[model samples]
Target chain A: MTSHPPAGTPSGIVLEHVTKRFGRTEVLTDISAVLPPGRIYGLLGANGVGKTTLMSLVCNHTFRSGGTVLIDGEDPAENPVVLGRTCFIREDQPYNDAFKVRDVLSAVSWFYPDWDAALAERLADRFHLPHRTTCKKLSRGQRSALAIVISLASRAAYTFLDEPYLGLDPSARGIFYDELLLAYSEHPRTIVMSTHLIDEAAGLLEEVLVLHEGRIVLRADADEARTSAFVARGLDSAVTALVGHREVLSERRLGSILSVTVRGARTADDESRARAANIALEAASLQELVAAIGIGGIGGVDTESFTTQRTSR
Target chain B: MTYARRSLRLYLANRSYVTLIPGGILVIMLAMSLVIGVAIGMATEFPLSAQIQEGMRENNGGAVYSIPGFLISLGALAVNRNFAMALAFGSTRRHFWLGTLMGFGLTSGATAASAVVLLALEKATNHWFFGVYAFDVAALGKGDYVLTFASVFVLAVLSLALGALFGTAYRAFGTKGALLTGLAAAVLVVAVTLLSASNKEIVGSWLGALGVWAAVVVAAIAAAISIAGSYAANRLARL
Candidate 1:
């Protein structure tokens, strides 16, 4: 079953000063961003940093404490027309106890205005999900695969996938990536995906939003984000000297050697200085960047002593 | 498809839960009642019609409880499972609630219609030709088809509404909230019962004036209250 196509061009999602709190524990605070239509965006953040909460709030699965969420220039909360354009399946999406895989597929097909039965069947076959088996009996990977099939087949205008590849094997994950790209190519729409496998999904994202401690710390194009920070590795004193006054994200020392993740792109002068100081400068990967920003707070410069106590050999 | 229609379809998809299982239970209960009635008739060798009439008069009509029991559980499961699934599939809470109300009405109507059919059959068969008196018992409107339909329909609606209320409460406030709500309801019921007992003459006269419709009116009012409470709780609920 399907309905009429959405009229006019998509206006995309706009969040303004969004705040969420659960009994005084603020989950998302002052989070604001503009996600233009028809692009794949990666929502990156550490565990419990409100990556899931943000997605839920956008999809209106959970109500926001404050701020406005507009989807296609309309509020999504309890608006069927607006919600119909969205699809969000949680990592542990609940299913009826008696619902078999086929039952779930059949039930969900009715809600999405553009549900593709053929695509659903094909994806289910690819995932090898047994139609007769109840969802409670499905394995973790199989459950994830089921969620993926619904998300892809629904073909909603704005699809949000939160840790969609939780328990899938490497081969299955590969299939997911291939299918996701294939689906996106075939039908261009806004997709916001949250995943811990940053580098693996980096190629698919046009923009990356790094959320840290209930706030958006960085939002930039994927290419720009890759060079947003750099790592300096060499002797402690030399690396320290090269780092200078630049904000340090994280630091680690093995014996006398020290490596520090510094914010900002490496300049030509800084590179030459690093060469002279016998320190290697490398552009931090997306994974490294997320870890640094998430683990070490934004502009969290290390001021502790770098001296390593020598042990008796 | 409209969201409410889609949600209704999804909720009613499980025929085994909404119809077959409860229907099967009713049949089993009727069969048991028939067997016991026949055995008593054969062992006593008394006037079968008089014995059956006496049995029917004394019968508490516990068999009718099965349908409402199943419906109540179905309503709760719908909130716990179907509500989340519908939202995931992009359904609004308002639409889900609308769909659920439609589902409750349809299920209750169907069950009531089935009860009416059973009562008609019992009458036509002259109590299954053995004076079983299962569907014709005093608890189910004393063999009155219209009264049975009204009573069963009201009971089913009330049961489903109460179940949705408790389920929504659980969703909005967790287990502790649900427990507190249940406790509060119990206290209210006890208090009402005590007050009614204290003013038995007045309460009895009022109920007698309304006759059979009193129970129906009371159940309908409770159902309405439950529906309102469930909607409020649903508004505050999160997936």
Candidate 2:
């Protein structure tokens, strides 16, 4: 009803050469990145790409093989103060199936000093979880909803959602996204969400951190990341004339219209030349940029001058 | 919530495994005991005298073998598996053993009570042991009744202790732990049998038999205390 006050401005989370290994198999290797806080963070990576492992180290769920991770400031391992301030909803959170929803709610309430019981119940109702139904009987989606409820209700200073919507349908996901944004607007806590559905969730994330094979391939503002890359389409000769020697991420020819994702921003001259050549330039979505970076971010990229790169839409 | 309370709750909610499995085995055990009792009757031609003779010495004391075997099987992983439920509630390992024992203890009490009642009724009429008068046990004057009842109490207690011993030691041991438990049980059986055979009148005096039983009961209780206490300290420390 009232005008929303600006969300609390939180700085960034820094990971310094953080590496984690489980026995002999190395899950993550030399992962270092600085993620600005306050804004929603989308940790984009394929499955087994070390997104979950990195998040675990960040939350101190498991020990790291090497390196350090800082949450705003200070280490998180065994520090009750830090752990209490964090809410990490594991994919398959261990809970007794015989326990009714209400029991789990009450138990978790005690774990978090700032836990909001009212918020938890409200979210439970929103997700249609019957208080009488024990956790074992609850559907997988219901389990995830319960997890979402706990994480949001905890109001933990740092919240990590690791693929929170794996089995959720689009409509259910829409509800989750809406509730998440609403909650974030009301209480601005640091949120790091890892997901495989990059395109579907593109609109919800404010920033992006792309991890490829246990390393941060790209990190920047979601919009800026999209804007910084574009696909210019026109006659191959005409488009080639505009683009000389810039880094070309990828190019695909659909009949005569040539579309190529090029790195670097579009200059004024390049825009005019594209307009003169009657070419169309479309801004790359976060999904496209991620796909391009994920495929071959820094290595094996073809280099060409990109002058006609401009958003036509 | 306190760790104990949380563990109790977790134990209550755990359903990945069913308690019914061990419970069903318990029913089968009781039936087996009765069936074996009948087979003893038929094979011995239902002659009361031969049956009595066979009861005291058949198969290295069949009734005695039943006592330890039942306790070991009941107290082993069949009971320990229930502890896994406690982990869901974030229960410490110490509480896990306690809760599991408490659960199996209740079941053990019911079965033992029924068995004792049946045995008492049988002993009232059938005087199997020579010179051991049934009325003497009932007299309660020379403390013979106390001695016998106490033996029953000690047996029940020691059997349960043996069970809890296996359960606690096997709690962290997964499936492999069960195999180790079986091997240990077999070895204990052999040792007890050999010792009893070497020393014929194992029951020197009724009071002495009760004393040995009492000692075993006390030792079992002490071991349970030590194991559970150590588990608490270790859990507080870490994995």
| Candidate 1's TM-score on the B chain | 0.92
Best by TM-score: 1
lDDT of 2 by residue, B24-92 (tens): 443454456445555665665443355454433333222233455655555553334334333322233
B1-239 in candidate 1: lDDT tens per residue? 36799889987989667765655667877788777877888886533668556766568485566777777887888888888898888888888888988888887887788778878888898877766777777777787788889988888888888899899899989999889878977887899899999999999999999897888887888899889989998888888
Give the per-residue lDDT of model 1 (tens digit) for A1-313.
Answer: 1121244348788888899999989999887777889999999989999999999999899999999888887888888988988999998898988899999999988888679899999999998999999999999999999999999999999999989888899999999999999999998889999999999989899998888888788788999888878999999999888888877877889998998888778999998999898999999999998997766665321112111121211
Compose the digit string of candidate 2's lDDT tens values, residues A1-313: 1122233324446677788876688887777666656778999976678887787677665568898776656565645445556777777665554568887787666556678888888888888878888877878888888878877887877888878886777777887899899889998888889987888888888888877677676677777777878878899988877777766766778788787777777888888999999988777777777776656445321112212232221
* Chain A TM value for model 2: 0.82
Please count the clashing residue pairs in each candidate, in the order shown. Answer: 0, 7
DockQ per model, Cα: 0.85, 0.09
What lDDT does candidate 2 reach at residue A203?
87
